[model samples]
Target chain A: MPKRYVSIWFRYLATDLHSLCQPQLKSIPFVLRSPSHGRMLITSSNAIAESKGVCQGMVLADARAIIPELQVLDDRPDLKEKLLTKLAEWCICFSPIVAIDLPDGLLLDASGCTHLWGGDQNYVNDIGKKLHARGYDAKVVIADTIGVAWGTARFNRKYQVVSTNDHLSILQTLPPEALRLENETVERLHKLGLHKIQQIIKAPRASLRRRFGQDIITKLNRAIGTEIETIVPIMPVEPYQERLPCIEPIATRVGIEIVLEELLKTLCGRLTNEQLGLRTSILKCYRIDGKIEQVDIVTSRPSHNIKHLFQLFELKLQNIDPGLGIELFLLEAPRVEDHLPSQEKMWEGSVGLEDVRLAELLDRLGNKIGTQSIHRYLPDEHYWPERSVKLANSLQEKPIISWRVDEPRPVQLLHTPEPIEVTAPIPDYPPMLFIYKGKEHRIVHADGPERIEQEWWLQQGQHRDYYRVEDEEGNRYWLFRLGHYHDKSYKWFLHGFFA
Target chain B: MVVSKADIFKGLQTDLLRLQGLKSVNNCELNNFLGPIASAFPNHSFPLGVIHELISHRQEEVAATSGFVTVLLSMIMGASGTSIWISASRNVFPIALKAFGVDPDRFIFIDLKKEKDVVWAMDEALKCGAVSAVVGEIGEIDFKTSRRLQLGVEHSGVTGFIVRKASRNIGTIASVSRWKISSLPSEKSDRLPGIGFPKWKVELSKIRNGKPGTWDVKWFDGKFFPTHVPIDTLVASDQWHKKKTG
Candidate 1:
């Protein structure tokens, strides 16, 4: 039972970039160049350019002289590396272990992943198809070992799949460079009249190690099944959880609170030292009667304040019942963030914006009303009413763009613009009367249609013609015509209410 | 500073009032509630460290009740300390409170889904010594719940306000004072713009062994002005208008 490893080589990365970013250059010959000692050298070339006598390491002037219509681009190895890393991350969907091979390759330890996609053939085929759909021409090979997979992906023309029996036969045809060796090592092997891996297969091991040193034999052993390969995985984030065990079951709520306060004291110390704050925490009270009661609290921002955290916990404590007694308590911080220390002390210790009192208020409010419901909005640079306001991430995040106070915005804006029936004269005039939610309001005072065109690049939709109108009862409303008056899809909508 | 023969009894009365939690402002504030609203009470001032209940029997009257409470809350809250406002619905806009010259951030607004939690949270907030004041917008509060909150405020020396909607049972609860507030049409103005200064007809429905009467008050700028318009005068003015037309 041999393990299966999948290897993907971005053989034509430069051309694939051209196809992904600028699809118009897909059929043309593309070449990437880098400036070397004041002279441009070709870093990579597409199949079309290679077929037309263009090669990497060639002088740009000479390559251009051979194919005058070749598209030359600056070498973007950073972009290529980022693409490879992203592709490796994407491969985690198929296998839990995926490692990046720098500059243009990825290796997925597809030990158990192949059977999930039917078989080893389909597993490699599905990945290759997905990459191709995303404008990448990938060479995928699934073999018994990583070295065999790498050799097959680069050297084999059609059959890049290699099993245990076929791996040796495949290695016989591929060059020594297919084993991923240094240029000097491959050159020395070539000078010894051994260009293919099969030529060195029957060589004496002791003489090979003594003459060429250990590197060549090591490479040989790695290519064969003699040496083992391992991959390092991306580490997952560890949850911040602390557990406390009691000697005896405690029944009093005050007893449980005392334990909680002690636990929080220790946790806050660690969090502050690490400059981290908990956004959500859960206090699990395991009672001796086999009952588990948990109270969770969320903060508006990342907070590690012990007093504020205790007050928020105190609000939800009534929901917790001690019952017979409490045996154990566990406090878990599910969401943590890097929190920069706030300005708690103002001038001469005067209360400032980030006061402890304010934090307690926000935390207490966040517990009663959901944290999601508490929102502080700032103006955004958008003419669209829906996109005009953006929510602030924290209380201290000041708005760079000022609110457009010149235009009177409604005090209460509906989460969504509601459709309403309107009765008005001809095109684009303010509605004389409107019916919203089956209630009719006769408009008395009206303003003009302040037409706002749609941002077509962001979304293709109708332009809104907004009108501020006051009803007979002196209630003001913000109304808009969904699309252009000439368009057949035009409709009326009530957007918000004025104070 | 001398203790006269008659001044001894007057000193004894002042001391009695002070013992019943009557705190007098050092300076005269004719513009605020300390001038007129305070004198309308049995202690010759609004009693401190007690839960005050305000009833608004209609949807429109809730505004007047909140507006009237905002005036008292600003003074009781002082320039320091945080306030806990436990409400079931987020009907009172924070911006509207700002119009009353109050910083909305100074208040902790607890929006509970259940009415019982509002009372419980308010009671807990009242008991917390650090909190300066607590406001609970609840529906029906029984004597048991009211007495508990009353005891909490008494122990903590904090003030409490229970704002009930129109449909409350208003039977009897252990409260310092109970008032029914209704909004009145503001006076027509030629200077100020937007909505006029909030005017309310405050009726003292119940006060614990205290004077119960009605008063007309209006909030303008940052002060409360007592308008001298009683129920009899209003009816007399209507009769005079009919006679003049006839």
Candidate 2:
């Protein structure tokens, strides 16, 4: 049976965050050393460097003598792990099943998706091209077995393929070492006058299995295509997706609208069929050049209505450019879940109309203004005014309610409390006359000091005394002073105002 | 008889009951905020729906960030959800908000890189819906942008508070309400030179239905509770509401 496998290799430069983050040092000759700058662990990519007179496990002093220009970097496994994780996230665009082959490699199961971009060869070429364009030297090889592909991509490039019937013919031309056998085993084979893989192929299978153990022969046979290898492809996740392949390339707005209507119909059909709805749907204009432009619409609730979906698409599609004419349209439901349809008692009654209209309006406004420019607030458990509120996107779930200070609270809240010099009656009392924002204010009347303690777990926690004071003009303000300002001037701030 | 398209359609309808047989039910109005504020808003506490304008604003001052913080703190103390503050401004004062009864552990502050970052954080926070409200500082706001935010709030029913340092007269944008706040006077003590009982000249610049004018208010103790603030009155408390509090 035809099967698939992946080969992974890594290129690493030992350096702390500076060198690791710097794009220029990726190509430089470097070694990762321990914090003491002691022993150097030559990276896997240094095989070429080793052949050029460099050696692994060499002292820094000796290596410096061999290559005066060799750059030194501190090994940071933590940083490398972070970088690998980020790279894996970026790979989600290509394949869903991305496994970390660690220290710097990723194994992507691209078997099924190979046809999406033409074929396996083309897919590997595209991946290599993308990685190379991004300033990385990458190598890729695909074969029936993982062991063969791994060995071929790393060691023997020319003999990458081994046909089933021709495995004997191809196996003989390569050296016995190409099989990634132990150095001791190869040395023994050479002493036995078995320098070439063909010599081993001709040897009696019973003797080879008995001498080297059955594991060796089984691995060898698998690499030579005598046995089958299984590959696990990453399955596509169900994010609401809708596609419209146009009969003709659509360029005009009317043509786009027609396509959008048809696409909405399909999307709604899928939603109904799947018994699911979407809080958000991203409409993709898949151009012929394989470029995709997206416009996302958020709904208050999961909906499966064709007309409502069309209205949102209409607003979102207005800004999309059908450049060079759009041949295909794809709508992906990025967020979808099960939704219980509301049963209307009356046929003429508007069923979930308000929520739908609100969602459509939000979608329209999001398109017109900008997706990031607008936000709603959610509550966070923090006393700091700046950290108390959170930004929310409307597409997911609605926050239940806004935070309300039941007791007396400030009408105007300052982002940051600036220190004000005050000559108060006492250190604990509110300032009688204070200079704030370059202006001086006289205290006509005042209130109590609401003591708020800092969270000890935090590093810069402090104790504060907050007061709500009224000036002669009846303007309200929230003011506080940091406790225990021994040396520096006491820090006072105007926090908020009353409504 | 051989079935035509019309005959097939008729046959399909034989088992289908008329939709007219279904009885109509009244739409239940979505209840938004609870407690006294459940009725404070004309639309019942700004139901979790998108509004063109959130966090009513009348003036654009870099100093107004404190005002934004107070609104956020109030929501957190009174509402059912969590609170988060995404501050891209260098002027973020965490100490002051702590004094306003906001739970210190509940607040999460994310320092973003750019002005656009505040908006991005806001979008993510709004989508989470785990929090009750969000507050962010923006330099300027346009109609279309406010519309988008309003839609976002409406969709999730999360209230949003935007603090813009400067204003360029965005005439008649949609907002539940708008208010202009400035520092008033604080109380005095013989030992201290600074004021107490922070007062504010709060002008309701724009409200959905309420009057649009200025009201002299005081942040007494810690709340925005009504107080006898005689700012324009010629007489002091000796002649004014002193009769009541006294």
Candidate 3:
């Protein structure tokens, strides 16, 4: 016993398109026929047509002569292909793996899916009811082989299940035309009294091969599920789905929020089931008329938490203008990934609620003033005293640990070093009383000579001699003068104030 | 600028009320210094609720002033929260402040656009009441503006430090505690085999209710202990002075 290959063929006639295109054909006696075959291939009513002696492959002119009111229309291949694509999309409801069968069919590997719709018979009935409600006529057939299913769908019946052993007995009753053989082979078999598939199977293989070639017997054997036929379905495409089809178009902020909650619930549930989290979620609302309104939010980390995720969107919801009313709402996580939960005790302890609030405030401010307007200072890891900080935005992700400096620093640092016209004797001497802010104060007492050597590696290095000096009022200041040269002009800077 | 005898009595009363743990402008200040600086500076200690101006005419001035402020703040670094440094003009060198054990980890530097912005940010930081101190470098100051800031610090109770960089001379009218800092030649011999520690002279331009003059000081081995305040010794018998006092 050879291993079997089961192929289930799902055909959608696309009656919707047929009805739209052939609207005038309603209540009319119309027959779709092959131009070359000259027959009533598909008649609206065979009862009426049969009373007048009209049958398949009857000459159209003869059929028209028999029934003068007969209407013959040409087939549109483009329309049929478009309908097949839609049929493929509908089949995706059963499984993510559904591929289009060119012209008018879909090939689904419904092996594991039969139990989902409650067994094969119920699944077929359910699909049939759905299609019928949607104004489509659908047919499904399951067999051990692709060839048998193919032969069964067109040659068997509207509903079929050709089991392995019963395939031959069932196929034997089918006419030679049902084998889907080429015209030459069928004509050759017609001369041999092998009009029925059973008679063709009964004929001696050697004689059949001699007369009609091995392909006829081989095709016959494969069609009856004897020799296995494998089908390679077109690979399924990745889906980008986000749906919020509202029952009623919403127009107010409260209503929009309500709809948003429901949409987020459904979308988050789907993401959770798939074990995925969205990094970027875009909500596109289609207005009742035609225009589309969209809002997008990005999370610092991939997240699936419904409330936390909704909070981010709510902040942005204030900007959404609910113009007219939204008929369809789509929440799409265009970028998603598998979300793994990570505990954050370190950040929770180190960062205060004020820090989070400040970050949020900065984000809102940036949105209003433009993201480029807001800035934050980040410490630069360098030996240079003044050039140890860089500016960054609040939204930009950075390690919080780097924000802390490694060494002791000042309580107050000046914005700029003011040039003081000092009358100090030497390069290393602290300034006596230099004119500052245009007032003269005699240097009655002084302390310091903390020398900071130049960082020789950089071109902009400065040698500074810092001091802690007091004025007549007993005020203390942390000041420094540069050491660029022997008699370099002393630039006075108040770095910080003493307690 | 002149505090009357009645005002001194009032200040004493205020201090007494504050000592009783009453939350008032006078109560917010820390305990006075344990040494000579206690008499030299106003309020026995550096007042907390006041904007002290450290005016230096030259860049070398920051080192002189930073040395003193660093020594003063070394005791307060371990406390929670941070002291903010707002500098828009790139005057304060962070590493220079770091060398004095001011705990850069607890210091946050904010750079603003304009002088007015720096002042505005300082005012906001003062109101937040979380930071220990707020410091900024300003080039210009009027008497009225300084008075306004002094009132602000008094209300918020956080120390405010304004480093006013003067052009040619020390501006006497604007600051509560004004100092003139100048670099001094290292006291250690140049003939020494290695580079010696740097020394400086800090001129006390204004000391509220105390004498004002220059104090000779040396910052050696990264520490700033007063060097000129001589430890008087007994000439004949080293214990004679203590015996006399006893």
Model 1, range A1-499, lDDT digits (tens) per residue? 5788888898887668777788777788889999999999999888888889898899999998999898998886687777777777777887888888877888888887778889878888899999898878899999888888898898887775687788788877889888788888789989999978888878899988887778778777877878987877654344688889999988887897898899899888889999999999999999998889999998867889898888889888888988888889999999999988976544433233345555556567668756664555556788877777666676566667655655655544566788999998889678889998788988766666888888888889778888977666545667899877776788999876543
- lDDT (Cα, tens digit) per residue for candidate 2, span B1-246: 555987887655533312311111221222221222224333333323323232324322233336534543564435333555665653444334545555433444555557766665666556544455666666665667666666666546556666555555645555556655565444334444434444455555665533455554554333453336333331333554575477
Q: Best DockQ goes to which candidate?
A: 1
**lDDT, candidate 3, residue B144?**
72
- Measured against the true two-chain complex, the DockQ scores of the candidates, in the order shown, are 0.10, 0.09, 0.07
| Every candidate's TM-score, chain A alone | 0.55, 0.51, 0.45
A1-499: candidate 2 lDDT, tens digit per residue: 3555555454432232344468565556566555345445543324334545766556666777877777776655576667656666666666776655555566665546667878767767777777666545556665556656665566666643333454456555667676767777778878888877777877899999887777658767867767754544434355566677887777788988887777778788888888888777877787767777778778666788887677667766777887888888887777887877767645432212133443554454444445554444465576655665667544344445545454455534555566776767766677787777777767666666877777677647677788766556655456788775464545777766553
Candidate 2 vs candidate 3: which has greater TM-score?
A: 2
Give me the runs in candidate 3 sitting further than 4 Å from their true place. A1-241, A268-279, A301-311, A334-381, A390-410, A414-420, A436-483, A486-499, B1-246
Where is the poorest 10-residue window by lDDT in model 3 chain A?
A349-358
The docking quality of candidate 2, as DockQ, is 0.09
lDDT of 3 at A54: 68
Fraction of true interface contacts that also occur in model 1? 0.01
Model 1: interface root-mean-square deviation in Å: 5.8
lDDT by residue for model 1 (B33-85), tens:
44456556654656667899988775446656776787777776667545667
Global lDDT of model 3: 0.59
TM-score of chain B of 3: 0.70
